[model samples]
Target: MTDSTRPTALVTGSAGFIGMHVCERLLADGYRVVGIDSMSDYYDVALKEARHARLARSNGFTAEVGRIEEPERLMRLFEANTPDLVVHLAAQAGVRYSIENPRSYVEANLQGTFELLEAARAHPPEHMLLASTSSAYGASTEMPYRETMKADTQMSFYAATKKATEAMAHSYAHLYGLPISMFRFFTVYGPWGRPDMALFKFTRAILTGEPIDIYNHGEMSRDFTYIDDLVEGIRRLADAVPERPEGGVVPEGDSLSPVAPFRVVNIGNGAPVPLMEFVRAVEAATGREAEKRYLDMQPGDVPATWADTSLLNALTGYAPTTPVEEGVGRFVDWYRGYYAV
Candidate 1:
């Protein structure tokens, strides 16, 4: 039974990198957390289990193992927890992987989001925050992508599915009056980060004397947001729930939907760091130079991504403040300690 005195939050993908950090923050803030994760073998199940084990240390957390897309899975959890907050982070990640296995994206990103929306509709939460990606901005030459800008052109199936979820969520928010906030995350990296991410891969390769692959011939850049900063942004945004503006008059630069209590906010450092500079930061953190294998850009990849966080500041009075070098250093330290490398 959930404590009537404490707010309950249902976090999907609670064993994932961002999900674990978010769950920890919620637990610290006195919210009883109900977590559901499929514990997919996408990367390493041990890493996911480790994250879940850490969260289990808190009595406030209750873990359930199953895919969100599973029939009655999210619905049952919503009914049981009656969550005041919903943070949907589970998805088929990786741009290149989407090309190899597109069906997983359809099942996890599309069908899974559909199931979540249906569950939310049946049992409304105070706020439903779903993770989007800067990749949804897709091939936009715009230096700093804003939520108000057009984002119809997605370069990857992964991004396409994510963008589709935004639309799917918007309709549900409008029709069902569910307050929803979609987060457009930049390149998020930090301690307990996914092994598939560049920071982890590069750090591991550099420490192990293996060459790190430099895509786009080292001419790319990303707004690398630290995990803690991203989680803080999410925590604040949970309180800054969007309400459907009366008379459908949204303020300038606001991405709040005219007909729904829905909005899209970008959580990023708002600073794009060059790819090679990031590699240098890894070298600085690990005290070892990387043998770089420069390669052509992979399909479904953008050369650069920058974020406009003005809306995030306006709404939550917060913006991500971590530098890439420092964030990468933290990840490298964690990697060394975790892998004993």
Candidate 2:
């Protein structure tokens, strides 16, 4: 532990994409850290292992290879570590994948969170931030998603589970007095990104002379947030956790519960970029034009994802600011160096 004064924090899914970067930030800030991940083979197990390898090199960071849904294991870990703060990032992630495998989402997102909530009831952390997805804003054509907006209609099973997790977290917070923050992340990309993401697939296809699938007939757009920008938002959020309103009169239609210290925040680049523009940035970075495959929109996919991060900035004084062009270029450079393409 670098700073004994800093709280010990536990990050679930620390071997995953955002998890790896979050762990790095937590360690850099001198927090005694413990990371838990099952290292599921949803994408590439080697990629997850590589992330774990990097974190293992840090003295303040520790990891365990296990599943979070296992109640006994989770309980034992909580009992031993007694973490002062918890960042729940582990889950069976992917909107399209959820269409094929709904059970995985139930096991990881629902059951796993249930396990964590139960454990936290006995030993409550000062603050708990859980990962939610922008997909939670399903079926709403509203641009710039706000934290207070209603998102009852979810398009994907994965998103439904995540949205459900937010509800579950709120229940726990209200009943157990847990300070909880649920963050809805927009399209996140950068170094060490998941192989299934469009940016990674597009870059790989462009370099390999293969066709990249342009979904929604290439009309889709997203608030493509860089990993560093998102991580910075999360870091700042760790300290700006919500406290139960003294008067118990919370805002209306808000995810915030009057009885609990819980609220949802959107972490995204407010600027939404078109698909072609993002691809052009990648092309410029690789100096190669991609073979494009215009495909129909797949099930459980949205045409766009725009985040209204005004509430975030108003609360924490910061929102994600990375431009899509620069963020894409950085990812391409990392991909080329990583794969020697």
Candidate 3:
């Protein structure tokens, strides 16, 4: 704790790609940040460690290593710290991986969130923001996904688990009067991104003279959001705490739950760029033409994703604006510097 006067933020998955950036932003904003991460080997553990190492340089940051699903892990944290703001970003990520290992999804996304919500119920925060996914909009052919839209058709187990957590949070909010926001994120990318993501994999393959997989035969599109942009959204939304509507009269177009102090907002770039276009941007950034191997779309994968960010703008007066080309260029630069390529 740097100072008792400063606000405290407990951030789960603090060493993850998005989590690291969020923790850094909160620390920069002068908040005392307590971060918890399991350091799961799903991706490169070294990358996760490096993210935490950077945060350790900040005197305001306190790092904790443990699984969120572990019994009493989050409860002990809440008991000791009593955080003012809680950001739940920890989970088992990846749609394809979830198919191979559905149990991980159940443990991390489902059980882990149960533990978090229970802890929050014990020591309620001013605001709690949990990360959901655009994949929650599964099977919808709508051009741009919205927060108020019916998102019951989650295509993958990963998405299903994420949606389940949103429901779980809502129930807690209703029961305990906890202020909660569920953020439905689109395709996030940029510097310090995950190795499993397309931007990272494409950049790595292109630089190493290897072929990149072009799923759905380059017929895909994603609202590729930049890392900085996403972090800014999270920071802004932290202050936009939800309040249960009076008399159960919710405003039109608002996803705020009438029964609870809860809402779901879309955090995305708002522009869906085609797969070939994204690859071209990578090539431009890396100065290497990628060898492409066209393949059918993976199971549980959608061909396109677009976000409707009106609710986010309405609430926080901000939306993600980074273009894929610029975001991809920054990521390639970071990748080269990070790997010494």
Candidate 4:
């Protein structure tokens, strides 16, 4: 039953790392949340199930298990929920995985997004937020990537698909006057993160007395945004809906479309930390030194990613700034408790 007093948010990929956190935050804010996740075996299904279990404890949360790419799946969900807000976080993630299975990216990231757009077209939401990636600024060596910059050189198929979705969403926003905000997240880490992600992998290897691979020969850097900080940015951005600029005049450093109620915002810690320092943070948190095996850079990977979050600040009055050490420590605590290590 729909709660007339509270707004409903339909969040796809709700059992995933970021999706789970976003659903919790929305529910905490007194919104009825409808969460959907396919529970694909990209990582540990047990972990994803645990996340869903936590969300299920909340009475305001409703969970649906299914793939978004299925025909009429999203349309049925939209028609049933009539959600006022939509957060499209479901997609085939991982750069190396995309290299191994390009078709998954096509089906989930591209085709899945198409379905979401179609559903939103049929039943318009008050606002829609789509997840993009820092990889979308692929092959662009420009430090502190601004949203207004051209993102034409996607080095990886994963990045290319994400960039394509931005275009797809923009067209929908322009044609249907749908308010859309695309958030380009940096390297996000914290408790309950995906096992494939660096923080979780490193923590597990370190605790189990195994060597951790340091790609790019420990030369790479990343704007490591904490999960809480990233979630806070998304929560604030939900209310800071973009509008089409008047007379095609967008403010300086803004990525707002002049022809549509849409914009791309970078949600990242403005500071890029070295990979070695991040490993050290993990070591500190776990109280164990990692046997670092430095190696050459992997294909379809950038040496570094930095975000220029001034536009995000201007719009939402907030930006992710969590220090790596503190965030890593929090993750380590959760890992030890959860894994009984």
Range of the 10 consecutive residues with the lowest summed lDDT in candidate 3: 1-10
**RMSD vs true structure, all candidates:** 1.1, 1.4, 0.9, 1.1
Query: Candidates' TM-scores?
Result: 0.99, 0.97, 0.99, 0.99
Which residue runs of candidate 4 sit more than 4 Å off their true CA positions?
none
lDDT of 1 by residue, 218-297 (tens): 99998989999999999999999899999999999999999999999999999999999999999999999999999999
Question: Clashing residue pairs in candidate 2, if any?
Answer: 144-308, 145-308
Report the poorest 10 consecutive residues by lDDT, candidate 2.
Answer: 250-259
Model 4, range 179-237, lDDT digits (tens) per residue? 99999999999989999999999999999999999998899999999999999999999
Model 2 Cα lDDT, one tens digit per residue, 1-341: 33566678999999999999999998888888899999898999999999999988987888899999986777888898889989999999998899889999999999999999998988888899999999999999977788777899999999999999998999998888899999999999999999999899998888889998888888999999999999999998898878888788876545566788999989999888998899889888889888888999999899998988887787789977778878888898888888887
User: Model 3, residue 336: displacement in angstroms?
Assistant: 0.6
Question: What tens digits encode model 3's per-residue C-alpha lDDT throughout 246-320?
Answer: 999999999999999999998999889999999999999999899999999999999999998888899899978
Error of 1 at 316 (Å): 1.1
Q: What is each predicted model's overall lDDT from 0 to 1?
A: 0.94, 0.90, 0.94, 0.94
- Candidate 3 residue runs with Cα over 4 Å from true position: none
